[model samples]
Target: MTDQPAPTDVPTIRTLVRLAVPAVIVGVVSALVLFALDWIADIVDKGIWTALPKAIGVDPASGWWIFGVLSITGLAVGLVVWLVPGHGGPDSATTELIEPPLKLAVLPSLALVTVLALAGGVSLGPENPIIAINTALLVALVARLWPAVPSQLIVLITAAGTIGALFGTPVAAALVFTGVVAALKTGGALWDRLFLPLVAAAAGSLTMTLLQHPKFTVPMPAYTTTHPIDILSGLIIGVIATLIGLVAVYVFPLVHRLFHSIGNPVIYITLGGMVLGVLGAIGGPITLFKGLSQMSELIQNRATYSSGQLALILVVKLVALVIAASAGFRGGRIFPSVFIGAAVGVLANALVPSVPMAVAVGCAILGVTLVIARDGWIAIFLGVAVTGSIAVLPLLCLVILPTWLMVSRTPEMRITLPAPAKDPQTPSTPASPSPGA
Candidate 1:
């Protein structure tokens, strides 16, 4: 492959336009793929949670049903991962939010497992695997159609598009990818560097929005007035939640290893399902799945749950997130972290009515997200999006400083980086050539 000029340094206006058109197409296609995956998962969720239970003559919401469905889901996932062609396309526990594109042959297994986890009541998100799938598929397609386009460029646009689709807005993708683009030393104005990717993200976000209403907003009282107490409460909530997430971060490795000790996907994943089933029985259905709809559900039905009930939900969901992530399930952590933060926010409002509802929720999200994702900007974006109140933005920006300090010195909630691969030609034991042999 030949090295080419950075898109940011393209010579003419026509070139920028040329790059952005394909990017827009990539974004639209990526968002469509995401929508298709979710549509399929939704159908499966109803079959398991509704049709199957009715046929079996059990209450769909019963603990027995939740446990039975989740365990069966786990067994199914375990069997596919163990026997499938590509081992489920890399353990999500070991990968970052975005990694290199997977080989195309691995996409189906990855997609199948991802849908299973979602439909089966697993407490993980689709972000990590979906991003991998889109990146790989897009890279391959672009290479076939326009071989001159660089692989890295396609990767950035595809990722940006998926992120935009996930958050239902181009802004989230922009915030998420800002640090990435800025890091490239190829020198240009940041937005110039951001141009093609942002175009793709906007297209993706628009497509998802047109397909369905975006879920970014929650029905909360408008954050109208601000007092010194608001900042104080927000900071306190942020600090406490960060500390809570840290416990899971530290404990994650031990739990991951314990499940891995089972030594097979069918075994470990099945065991993971059983643990999730028990937790589901304890926490009930609210603690299941990726937690987006559930997050809104908790807020919409806030009056139904006692403060103590909210606290239990928080703890149970936190544990479920850990077990699902550690136990070889194919999913992402961000949505669950958001759910945990939202739960924490609800609890904070119940315990201390003095704090504004939006502020409490935003801060809770900010803190937990900071610890789990270790991305300050994206954390702030989610916090604001949850509350739908820009009034809390400045306060959140201030509190994020302390939250970052808490997260900065801690171990990230990811597996240790794999050891570098040794070159096959490099000798395990260096030997000198026999003298003039």
Candidate 2:
């Protein structure tokens, strides 16, 4: 399959406008699919964490209950990977946020595992799997319907649509796609190339807003003033969180290798789940899941936690995120990293009361996200978005410079497997390990 759209020689505006119709379909359908998957996951989450516990007369918050549930959830997901078709697509730890479209057949199993991870309180998010599912489905459908359209272009529009839906804003899609489009060597007005993808993004974003209106921000105090000391605080917090994230990044491959050594998804994933349960029990309910709602809770109750308590929560969540990602869980790392960043920010504020809450949070998030995603646009966007403040943007923009410097040369949170043995007639290539191997 082609990696990108066939180079265009300045297509007319009319052609671009014509493509907008399909882009809208791509966007709307992607958003609806994302919403449906998330809805199912939420129901399952409530059932396991609430209904089951209540029926059994066990406190969901108890250490034993938390540990037992997570262990079983891991075993259940392991069975899916072991027995399901497509093996739940590729290993998420070895894949980028947006990769080549998967085979259509892999989408269902991939979606199933993703929903299980989300509901099972796995410390990962829906970004990677959902985007892959949308890309595969849309590319197949759009290519068949409009045989003239390049498959690569369909992939771009589909990814843009899902990202818009995931973040509840077309702007996030735009920011992400800018870097992607800039890398292509083509001869056309940049905006001309971007027009269709933006159309899809806007449609997807609007659809998600109408359906759920997902919000990333918490109830943090407003960031109104721009003080000189605030910049220093932002830089310090950003740098520290970036370092913490880098540690996890370096450790990721080792953890992944350790789990893969078990050679059985059932055993390793269960062990990972048990570890998560222990961490959850120690960190309490606030430290579990993908970290979106949990981050909000942490921020709202920042006053209740001392610096020591916040630090413990931060370490636990960061470690939990690493374990979940390394153990073949079918989810993304961005969500949990945001929670880690928030924890760092709140902890910083607790230690030093003078820094603005929003600044600390934004800068810390900016640092941690940059380290994990290695995407400056996304890291900066998340930092600003999570605080719900524009005033912190300038500080984050500055803080990211130093944080990026520190993390730029570090290895990413991904593994590089050994090359597979090839026959004389077959091309030798390396294959990524699937979750639970």
Candidate 3:
């Protein structure tokens, strides 16, 4: 019997180079595409709102009658999704979890999502789609460019690039990608090869940021609380946030089924837009689009929304997100989830009166942690960072431990298993002799 060459004899460096270069290219391209979409969406959002007053003969800067702006935006989103190729929008975490990744479809997928966000009038966010599409594109590009690259390496580079672009920091991106790759069980060796692509993606993201400043820039906050009780508040909020996270997971699958069962994704998506439009009409213009700017406004003007209004917005926004997401619309849940968390925290503060602001911070942290389990630190960073309150980090850290515990306990957390390679030499069962034979 002839012996086949051992797998150990396979070349590794050659494989790594073949995978890393194209992965970087894909990451760079996807980042540029995402940035352009974001810029265009910003222009469209501002332009429509700006024109609303002029068209109706109202003052543009007054910010009153902004409901009209929301409705128009919702209609635009509906139209785009209805006519777009991917129907509803680009692939998201939800989609990635459900469907196999497609490389060449990134651009169209991105376009669909950009349009969906424009129309849905949902206070969602962008990071999810940006990551999903970029990852898929980079992975696809690497496979196409280097047919010899291992599948595992391709997955790592895609993951790294996607994460790198999102944070505009390769280190953080690498951490996120590593965590996700680990969760997906793609293996550890790919991480070593991911270094170059990670660097390239971070550079690409930084370049994009320099060219067109992002509205949501992370800032360091000043910490002030020295009290033990305040530190304890973090633990309390983290527990509460973990509870909310559980609820989000329970609700997500139902939402997914509901939309898919509706038969036609486009119709449901358009309906989702209409529903969002009505919500916008009733809830005010803040209910529309990715809530990046609104989240900033909320943090800056903490008193702008009354406790009751904040609570209402949280519920409405959550529902809108489930609908938009389930109905085939694309966008990230991270930002919307964050907005909900913040609102919940604010409402908790108003109700309890005695709970420190740190408790609310924990609430935000837990809410995001439950929905997104991969990088709990990012959620912690966001909850504290967005508040622009450094005094809360100690409390935020307290919440992180329990929130992690709670998510780790959840049984339904999505886990992606690696595909088993086909065995070419495995003997096929001999077919029965044909009747003619």
Best by lDDT: 1
89-180, model 1: which lDDT tens digit per residue? 89999988767778999999999999999999999999999999999999899889878777777888898899999999999988977877
Lowest summed-lDDT stretch of 10 residues in model 1?
Answer: 428-437
Candidate rank order under TM-score: 1, 2, 3
Q: lDDT of all the models against the reference?
A: 0.88, 0.87, 0.56
lDDT of 2 by residue, 88-185 (tens): 88889998877778999898889988988899888999999999999899888987887777766777888889999999998888888777666654
Arrange candidates, best lDDT first. 1, 2, 3
Candidate 3 Cα errors over 4 Å, as ranges: 1-27, 58-93, 97-100, 103-106, 139-152, 181-194, 215-221, 349-359, 387-394, 411-437
Residue 158, model 2: lDDT of 85
- Highest TM-score: give the candidate number: 1
lDDT, candidate 3, 1-437, per-residue tens: 02211222222454445444565675677568667766777676565666545777876333334444444444555555566555434435244421335545445746665644754355556666665555566556656665555444444455555555555556556545444434443233654434555755576667666766553432323346647765555566566656765676677667666755666545555565666666665666565566666655655565667888877877776666665555555666666766667666766666765666545644565556455544665676666546656666666666676677667756452323354686999775322111000
RMSD of model 2 against the true structure = 4.5
Residue 259 of model 3, lDDT score: 58
Residue pairs that clash (backbone atoms under 3 angstroms), model 1: none
